[model samples]
Target: MEARLKFAVALGAALVLPAAVQGADYFVTRQGNDANRGADWATSFLTVQRGVDALKPGDTLTIGPGEYPENVKLHGFGVPGKETLIRAELAGTVVLRGDRDVDLDFAQVPGRRFVYIADCKMDVLSVHEVDTLTNLAPAADPGALEFGPARYWHDAEAGKLYLSTSDFQPATCHRYTIGVLRDHGVDMLQCRRVVLDGLAAAGYRTAVGKEGLLLPTSGFMLHQTEQCTVRRCTAFFNGSGITINSGVGGRTDQPGEGKGNLVEDCRAFANRLDGIVAYNPSGETIRNCQSFLNQTYGARFYGGRAGDAVCLMSDVLAWGNPGADFWTKGGGLSEYNEAVLAERCIALRDCNFGNFQHGIIGGRNVYRGDRPHTIILPGEHEEFHQFNDAHFADPMNFDFRLQATSSFRQSGEGEAASGPHPYKADIYHVKPGGNDDLDGLSLAAAWKTPSRAVARLKPGDTLYIAPGRYAGDLALTASNICIRGRGIEPVVIEGGLRLAECRDVSVERLQFSGPARAIRGGNIELANCVLFGQSVEAEQVEGLRLNHNLLVASLRLVGCSGVILNGNLHAAAPAVQTDTRQAVRYSSYN
Candidate 1:
C-alpha cells in the first residue's frame, strides 16, 4: 500500500503503540491453485478467499492484477499497532467482481426483433457492453427490443436472457457480460484496524428478503468495524457502494464500537442505492471521495447524529444522484441534532437536496442542480454552478475533474475547494498508413486509425488527425478528448463518427461523407466540419453545438436540450428537423 493510503485523519488524540514486527506477505493470482499455500508468487493461491483466510495481524494479502469473482468477508480483528492489509499489487489493476462471465449462444426469437439465449438460470442485473463495462438499458418487454444499441430483458420463469444487437448475427457482431452474483463484494463484520487499498468492486445487486425488502449487498460493506480504512477504491453497479452501518443496532449517543472508521479517496457510481452510506455511525470520516449517478442519495447518513456520533465529510464530489448529493437524517431530538459536518464539497445535477440536511454544519460547498438546498454558516462558504459558464470538464459523462479554465481551479482561503485537478495531457497524432502498434504520442509514430487513437486517449488528451481519408464507423465512448483534423489538406472520414454516451468531446476541421447517427446521449461540439451524411441524427442528447460547419445532410435531433447552431451552412431543404425546444439557426442555405 502507498503511504497516502495508510495515512488517516485522526479525529481525536491517539497513541501509537510499539509496532509489532512486520509479518509474512502472501500473494494471490489467477494462474495459481488453491492447494498452494499463498507463501509467495511461485506458491500463490487461486482464490482471494484462500489468501485472506491465511492472514494474520500485520500480514499483507497482495492480489495480482486480475478479476476475482468472489464474496470476501473480513471477520478478524487486528491489533491496535499491527493492522491487516488487503491491497492490489498495482493500484486500480485488481478488480473484485461480484459477477461471473457467461457465454451466451443466442438465436433469433422467431418473429421478434430480439434474440434469446436459453438455460440462463440466474437473475441478471444487466447485460454489460464488453469494452466500456456499461450496462445496456433494460427493456420492459423483450419483444420491444430493437436492433440498435444494446438492450436486454430477462425472463426469469423461462430461464432465458433476451438481447437486442447491432446485427442479425448477435454472437459474431456483439460481445456482452451478464452479472449473476447478487451479493456483497466485500463484507467486513467486526473487523478492527484493517485497510483496503486500491481495490475495485462491481456488479452486485442485493437479494430480496421477506416482505420484498432488499437485503444489504453493497460493494464494500463495513458493519460494526472500528478504526478500519478504505482508500483509493472504486465501487460501481452494486446495491450500494461503500456502506458503514451498525447493522442491527439502534442509534446511540455514547461512544460505540462503530466509530473511528475512514473512507477516503474512493469513487462510487451507478449503484442501486446510496453511493456511500453510513447508518448509526460514530465519528466516521468520509473525505476526498466521489459518488455519482446512484439511484438514491450520493452520500447519506441515517442515524446516530449527536454527541460523539458526529461524522465528518470533506473534499467530496457528488452529482447526478436523483435523491440528494449529501443527506443527513435528524432524529428530532433537541440534544442529538447534528448529524454531519461537511466542508469543501461539490454537488451538481442533484435534483433533490444539494448538500443540505436538517442537522448539517460546517459547509464550504459548491453546488448546482435543478433544485438546490443548503443552509449558511460562519467560516463556511458556498458557491453555485451557473448555467451560462463552464464549471467542470464534463459532468454528463461523469468526469467531474476541474478544468484548467474553471475559476475554481485556484481557490482563495474562504472558498470551497474540491474535485480533482486537471493536468496537461499529451497530444497524440493519427494519419493514414501509420502503424497502430507504435505509440501515438508524436506525428512520426502516429496511429493508423481514429479508433486506435481514441482507445488510447485519456480524459484531457487530444487526437490530431493528419490530412487524408480514413475509415470511420467509430464508436466513441471516451469523454473530454478533443479530435481535430489538419484542415490544410481536407481530412475526411468515409463512414462518419458515432458518439455513444460520451460527453464534452470536440471535433474540428473534419469531413464526414457517409450516413450516420452522429450523436446519442451526450454533450458534443462540432466546429468547421463538413457533413455529407444522408441524415445526421442526435437523440436524447444533452448538449450539441455546431459552429461554422457545412452540413449537406438534414439535421434530426430528438429529445435534446441545450443545443446551439450558429454560423452553419445547410444545403438540404428543411435544414434542421427536431423535437428539441432549443432555438436552431443557420448562417446560410444552399
Candidate 2:
C-alpha cells in the first residue's frame, strides 16, 4: 500500500498506548525570530512553516498576525485523540500568502515587442508562469488568465519568463488562486484528525509545469486524509478555496485516501475554479458556509469525477458565482447521482441557470431566483433552460432573503419544473371552512384545524394549508414532515404553533400573528413565514433553518446548535438573540 492510503486506514483501529501521551504547545508571532526557541511568544517562530515543521502528534500551533510567504505542507499524521491544531491567535487576521511580487523593471526583450523577466520565484513548478494580474490594466475576469499576469508566457525550454503590461510598471498577482500555487496555504498529505481554524489564505498558486497548464490549487487541501475539520476560515483570490480531495486513486499497490472531513463557517470568494470543492465522495460535510462571486463556480458538493459521495449541505448561502453556486452531478456510482441531502439552503442568482442543483432535495428549502428550476434534478442537466419568475430580497448586494410579499414565498414545491423526473410529492390540504369530519385530503375536503390533519404524515408527507383564518395551534411529532401554504393566498393561524418534541419538522408560507412564540424543536425548519407582533423562542435545535421570515419581535435560541439564519428580515428593534457559543455552522444572520 502507498504510505498515504495505508496511514489513513490505520486511523480506524483503536490504539491502547502503553504510556499516557501528552502533547506540547508552540507559538508563532510576527515579531519573534524563527531562530529562537519557539516555545512562547517571547521566543516564537517567525514563520508558520517553521511552526508547522516542528509539529508533533499532539502539538498546538498558535500563529499570530503576519505575512507568511511560504506554502505549508503538513506532513505527518495526527490521531483524533491527539489532534494537530494550526490556528491563528485571532480569526481572519493571519494571512498565508503564496506569491510575493518583486520590484521589477521588465527588461526590454531585445528586439521583441514584450519584455522578459526571470528572478526564478516561478521555479516552484516545472513550467513557470503567473496565474492572474493585479493592478494591471483591465482587472482579471473569470475563467481566463496568464499563468501568473495581464499577458505573460513561460519558455521553460529556454529558462526565461516574459510579460507585456503596455505600461512598464510591475503588476501584482494572486495567481493560480484556485489550483496550483507556488504551493498551498495549507497542504495536507496522508493526514487525519487535524483542525484548521480562523485564518485567511490568499495569493495561492495552481500552475504545474509538467501538466503544461494552469492547474488547480486549494488554499487548504486534504489528500489521502480523513476526519479533519476546517472552521471559521476564509479562502479567496486563490486557484480554488478549500478542498477535501481524492489523491491519485489506488493503483495495484495502494488505495485512495480522502474522505469524511468537515468544512464549516468558512467564506470562499473570488476563487478561480471553485470556492469550496469536494471531489471525493467520503461522507464529507459543508455547513453554515457561503461562497460568492468566485471567478468560475462557487461551492461544489460533489463534482462526480471519479466517484460520488453522500455529502450533506445545510444552511449554506451561495450566490453571484457567475457560474452556478452549487453543483452535484451524477457521478461514478449509479446511486451516487441521487444520494445527497440538502436542506434550508438559500441558493440564488448563480449565473444564468438554477442556483442549486442536486439529485434529491428536502422541503422548506428556500430556492428563489434560481432557474430553469430552483432545485435542478438529476438526469436532466444537458437539457437545462433558464426560466424566469424567481425573486430575491437584494441580489445586487448578495442578499437572498425572501421579501414579505414575494409571490414565491413558501413555494418550495408545488408544480415541478420541466425535467426527466419531476418531484411527485404527496400534498394534504387544510382549509378553515372545511369540515373536521372529512379526510382532509384536498382543498374542498380540507381540515379545519392544523394539528389533527397534519398528524397523518410519514417521512415525505406534506401538509398544505389554504388561505383561511384557522383556530388553535399545531404540533410537529413526525420526522421529515413538511407543511406549506397554498401559493395563491395566505394561511393565518390565530393560535400560532408549538414545537416541543418535533424532529426534522418544516413549516413554511404561514403568517402567525399573536403574543405566542414557537420554540423547542430538534432539526426544525422555518422558511418564508411572517411573524408580526409575536416572538419566537427556539431551543434544542440541533440543525435549525430560519430563512426569509419577517420577524416583528426577536427570535431566540436557547441551546441551539448549527443554526442557519439567512435572508430573514429582522425588526428594527432587538429582533434576534442566541446563546449558541458553538461555531456558527451555517450561513449566519443575513
Q: What is the alpha-carbon lDDT of model 2 when measured against the actual structure? A: 0.62
Report the poorest 10 consecutive residues by lDDT, candidate 1: 368-377
Which candidate tops TM-score? 1
lDDT of 1 by residue, 176-284 (tens): 6677766688878778889999999987765534211212578898877888999999998777889887534434333246668899999998777879987776678
Q: lDDT for every model?
A: 0.69, 0.62
| Model 2 regions more than 4 Å off | 1-22, 102-149, 154-181, 206-215, 247-255, 301-309, 320-323, 330-338, 346-392, 411-590
Tens digits of per-residue lDDT, candidate 2, 1-590, equal: 59978877666443534234556778898787889878988999988888988888878899986567778888657775777888988666577876553444345555544344554434422121233322122223211223233445554466455554424344232232112246567888878888999988876745433321112676787776778889999987677888776544322122256667888999998676778876645677888898877776676754343335557666677766766776654343213233465544545543221233422121222323332334432223333211111232223333333333333344455653331123332546677687778765555566677878877777877777767777767665677788877654677877666776678888888887764344555778889888774667776767787888888787776878877677789884565677855723544335
What TM-score should be assigned to candidate 2?
Answer: 0.51
RMSD to native for every prediction? 17.2, 14.0
Q: Judge candidate 2 at residue 90 and give its lDDT.
A: 60
